[model samples]
Target: MLACLLLAQLLVAFIGRSVGPLGVLIGEDLELSKSQIGMLPAALFLGQAIASIPVGFVVDQTGSKTLLLLISLCVGSSFILMTFSHQFGFVLFLVVIGGLGYGAMHPVTNRGIIHWFQRTQRGFAMGIKQTGITTGSALAGLVLLPLAAMYGWRQVVAAACLLLIMGGVVSYTFYHDSIKETNQDKKNLASFYGSMKHMVRNKPLMLVSISAMGLSGSQLCLVTYIVIYCYEYLDISLFLSGVLLVISEICGSIGRIVWGIISDRLFKGKRVIILMIISGIAGVTSMILAFLPPSTTFGVMIPITMVFGFAISGFNAIWMNVASEVVDTTFSGLSSGFSITLGSLGVITLPPLFGFIVDFFGSFTAGWIMIVGVMILVFMLLLLLLLEIKTRAAY
Candidate 1:
C-alpha cells in the first residue's frame, strides 16, 4: 500500500508542477511582467481552492481510490488541453482545471493512506507518498525545462499529460480501498458537526489550520517563483535551476520518508511537536541563506531551501494524522477535507501578496523574508502541541 501511495505521489507531482516551467515559457513568449506571470499560478491555486470543499465531500461519498482515478483523468486531460493554450486567457482556464485536479489529491489521498497504514508506520508511509511531489518536481525540472528549451513550450505541456495518463491507467487498475463502515456514533450530521465543533471549540484545529496555511502558502510561493528567481536573481541557467529543484526534491523526498520513520520510532508515533521543531529549524536556516550575498554560490541555495520544504511537508503529512486521532474514523474524509480547504487559503493569498511585494519593493529578498516568516509559528505551535501531547486529552 505504501508503494502504491508512493506511485500516486509521483504521478501527482508529475501532473501538478508543469506550471513553474510553463510560467517561464509564457513569460518569455507572451512578454509577461512578473505580475502577469502570476496569473497562471494564481489560477491554479484558485482552481484548487474552488474544488477544495467539493473534493472532500466526494471522498466521503465515494472513496479515495475512486477519487484518485477520476482526478488523474481530469488532471491529465487538463494537461492535454494545456497544449492548445497560446493566449493568457486560455492558459488561465486550463490552469484552473489543472489546479482543481491537483487539489483533489489531498483529501482523497491523505485519508486513503491513513486508512491503509497503521499509526506506527504512517509517518514513513505518507512520507514516501509525499516524495511523489518532489519526484514530479525533479522530473519537471530536468525534463520540462529542457523540452521547452529545445522543442518549444508545447512539448513540455504534452509530456506532463503523458505521464499523468500512464499513472491514471495504473491507478484505475490497481488502487482499491474497501469502504469503511461509518461509525455508529457518526451516523448523524449533528454528531459530525458536534465532533468538528469540539475540535474547533476545545482543541487546536484552528492552530493546526494556521500552521497548514503557512506551510502550504510558503511552499507554493517557492514553487511559483524559484525558476524565475534563479533566472532573474541568481544568474543561473534554466537547466541548472531545474536540476537544482530536482536534487532538492530528491533530498526532500528522502527527508519525508526518513523523518516520518524517525518521528514515529523516536516519538512513538506522536508527530506534532517533532515536526514543529523541524519546521522552525528549516525556516530559520532557509532565511539565513536567502540573505547571503548573491553569487555563483547561490546555485547552492536550493538545497538550503529544500530543508524547509522537507520540514513543512513533514508536519503537513501528520496534521491529518493527528486530526484522525482526534476525530472518529468514519469522518476522516471530512476532517481532512476541512483542514486542506482552509489551509489552501494560504496558497491563494501568499503568491500574489509576495508578487506585489516584489513588484513594489523590487527585491526578491523581502519576499523570501515573508516566506520564511511563516515558520515563526512553527516554534510556537510545536511548544503548544508538545504541552498538549503530554496531556493526551487536548483533542
Candidate 2:
C-alpha cells in the first residue's frame, strides 16, 4: 500500500513539476513573459487550493483507493488533452484541471499512512512517501527536459500522461483500504463545517499551516527559476541547468528520509525543532543566493543548491506529519487538506511574485531576498508554535 501510494504521488507530481524544466520551452513557444511562465505553475496550485478541503472531506468519508484511481485517470487525461492545445490560456486551463487532481493527493495518501502506521513509525513512513514528490521532480529534470528538447514538450507530456494512466490502473489493482469502515466509524464523521471549526481551532496546526505558506512559496520559486537562473545568470547550459534541478531533487529525496529518521528516532516524534532547523538552513541558503556573483563556479552552486533543496524541498514530510498528528486520527485527512490549502496560497502567489520582482528589478537578488524574508518569518512562526507547545505542557 505504501509503495502504491508513493507511485501514485510520483506520477501525478510529475506533470505539475514538469513546468519547471519545461518553462523555457513553453515560454519561447507561447511568447510568454517570466511572470506568465510563473503563472503556469501557480494555476496548478490554484486548482489544488480549490479542491483540497472538499477532497479532504471526501477522502475521510470514502477511502483513499477509489479517490487515487479517479485522480490518476482524470489528471492524466487532462494533461494528455493539454498536449493538444497550442494557446497559452488553453494549456493553463488544462493545467488547472490537472492540479485539481493533485489537490486530493495529500489527503488521500496521508489518510492511508494514518491508517497503516503507528505514531512511532509514521514519520519515516511519511518521509518515504514524500520522497515520491522529489523523485518525480528529479525524473522531470532528468528525463522530461531531454525528451522535450529532442521531441518537443507536447510529445513528452502526452507520453508521460499515458504512463500516469497506466500507473493509476496498476495502483488501483493492488492497493486496498487498510481501515474497514464500521457503522460507528461512519457515524462519527463530522460535518464539513464542524471539521473546519475544529481545524481552525487547532492553534499549533494553524500556526504550522501559516508558516508553511512561506516555505511552500520559497520552494516553488527555487524549482521554477533555478533552471532559468543557472542558464541566464550563471552562464550554464540548459542541460546542465536542468541537471542542477535534478541534483537538488535527489538531495531533497535523501533529506526527507534523514529528517524523518531524526524526528522519529532521535526526537521521539518531535517535529517543530526539525522545522526550525529547516527554516534556518533555507534562510541562509537564500541569503547566499541573493548575493551570489555571476562568476560563481558551478561546483559552488551545487552545494548551495543541495542545502537549499535539503531544507525547502525536504521539509514537507515533517510538516505533513505534524499537521495530521495535531488533530484526531479521524480528521487527519481534513487537517492535511487544510494545511495544503494554506500552503497552496503561497505556492500560487510566490512564484509569479518572484518573477515580477525579477522583471521589475532586472536581477534575481530581490527575488532571493524575498524568499529569505519568508524563511525568517517561517522561523518566527515555528518559534511561537514551540512556545505554545511548551505552554500547554506546563499547564
Candidate 3:
C-alpha cells in the first residue's frame, strides 16, 4: 500500500511536468515564437490552479480513491490527446487537459498522505512522499528530451500515455480508499466553516499561512522561469541546463527526505522554526546567484540551485504538517487546497512576468531580486509567527 501510494505521487509529478523538457523541441517542431511556447506552460499552471481547490473540495466530499482514479484516467487520456495536437491553440488546449489532472493531484495526495501516516511520523513520511514529484520531474527531464531527440515528440507523448495507463491501473487495483484518521478528519462545511473560523482566529497559524504564500510564490517563480532564464538570459545550452535542472531536482528529492527525517527526530517538532531558517538561507543564496557575474558558470550554479531546491522543497511538507496542527482537522484538505491555490497565483503571474522583466529590463537580475525579496518577506513573517506562538503560550 505504501509503495503504491508513492508510485501514485511519482506518476503525478511525471504528468505534471511532461511538457517542460520538450519546450525547446516543441518550439522548433511547431515553428513557435518564444511567447507562444511560453503560453503552453502558463496555460497548464493556470489550469492547475483553477482545478486544485475544487478537486480538494470534491475529495473532501467523495473520497481520495475516486479522485485518484480520475487522475490516472485523465493523465492517460491527456497525453494521448496531446500527441494529436498540431497547432498552437491545440497544443495549449491539450496541455491544459493534462494540467487539470496535475492540479487535481495536489489536494488529493495531501489528504491521502494525511490519512495514511501518523502525526508523529508525518513530517518525514510526507516529505518522502512529496519527493515523488521531484523524482518524477527529474526523470521526465532526463528521458523526455532524449526521447524527443530520437523518436519525435509524438512518439514521446504516446510513450507517456503507456506509462500513465500502467500507473493508473496500479492506483485503482491496489489503493485502499479506507484511510485511518490522522490529525485531520471531518470533510463537511459544518466542520469546514467552523475550522476556518478557528484557524482564522488563531494569530500564529495565520502568520504561518501568510509566510507560506510568500515562500510558495518565490519557489513557483523560480522553478517556472529558471529554465527560460538560463537558456534565454544566461546563454546556457538548453540540453545541458536541462540536465543541470534535473540534477538540482535530484538533490531536492534527497533533501526533502533528509530534512524530513531531521525535523521528525532532532528538530522534535520545531518544523516551523526550521522552515523559517531554511527560507532565510534560500533567500540569501538566491540574491547571490542572481547577482553573480557572467564569469560564473553552470557548474558553479548547480550546487546553488540544489540548495535552493532543497530549502524550497522541504517547505511543502513543513507547511502542510503545520496546517494539520494549526487548523481544525476537518479543514486540512481545504486549507491545503486554498494555500496551494494561493501559491498558484505566483504560478499564474510570476513566470511571464519574469519574462516580461527580462524582455523589457534586459536582465534576470531584476527578476531574481523580486523572487529573493519574496523569500525574505516570508522569513520575516515566519519570525513574527514564532513570536506570536511564544506570546500565546506564555499566557
Highest-scoring model, lDDT: 2
Query: Candidates 1 and 2: which is better by TM-score?
Result: 2
> For residues 230-280, could you state the per-residue lDDT of candidate 3 as single tens digits?
777667877776776677678778877877787889887667787887788
Model 1 misses residue 198 by how many Å?
Answer: 5.8
| Candidate 1 TM-score to native | 0.89
Which residue runs does candidate 2 get wrong by more than 4 Å?
A: 180-184, 187-190
RMSD of 1: 2.8
Regions of model 1 farther than 4 Å from truth: 179-202, 388-395
lDDT of 1 at 281: 67
Tens-digit lDDT string for candidate 2 (58-79): 8888788888889998789998
How well is each residue in 1-395 modelled by candidate 1, as lDDT tens digits? 55655676678667677676557776888788777676666777777777765676556656766677778888888878877866878877887888887877777777777677677877877776777776777677777778888888777667777778787778767877754623223234555566556656635555666677777777667667777777777777777766666666666677677777877898788777766776676678657646766574544676675675566544556666665555666666666767677677887788778777888888788887886677786567656766765776545
Comparing 1 and 3 on lDDT, the stronger one:
3
Clashes of each: 2, 0, 0
How far in Å is the alpha carbon of 335 misplaced in model 1? 1.4
Ranking by lDDT: 2, 3, 1
